[model samples]
Target: INYYVITTFVFQSAIKLALFHTFWWMFSQNSHILFHEMMRKIKYARIAFGHVLFDDT
Candidate 1:
């Protein structure tokens, strides 16, 4: 009975850790993609602004 109880506890903890790792991996991947998209947009905006300023001059 004691062994059964210990095994169950260990199984539950292992499942929880796996789930946490999956969630964290997904979150990081999504954030990395978002950051890249934001950087691209900022770069484009800066180029456009520079062109406009040059045109004005």
Candidate 2:
């Protein structure tokens, strides 16, 4: 019984650590992609607004 409990505890802890690492890695990757997409949109918006302002002038 004691051995089984110890093994179970170790297995649970290992799975938790692995899940934590995977989630962290995924979060960082998603944030990086989102950041780049936001920048691209901002750049495009600026160019579009500039054209509109230029036409009005």
Candidate 3:
């Protein structure tokens, strides 16, 4: 009986850890993609603004 209880606890702990790691990894990847996209957009905007300012001057 004691052995069964221990096994059950271990199994639950492992599943919890795996789920947490998977969720964290996915969140980090998503954030990284968003950051890169935002950077690209900012760069494009900066170039466009510069062109407009130069044209007006």
Instruction: Report clash pairs, candidate 3.
Output: none
lDDT of each: 0.60, 0.60, 0.60
Candidate 1 local lDDT, residue 31? 71
- Determine which window of 10 residues in candidate 2 has minimal summed lDDT: 48-57
Runs in model 3 deviating more than 4 A are 30-57
> Which residue segments of model 2 deviate by more than 4 Å?
30-57
TM-score, ranked from best to worst: 3, 1, 2
List, residue by residue over 8-40, the lDDT tens digit for candidate 3.
576566556655655665577787765665566
Q: Tell me which of candidates 1 and 2 scores higher on TM-score.
A: 1
Task: Name the lDDT of candidate 3.
Answer: 0.60
Off by over 4 Å in 1: 30-57
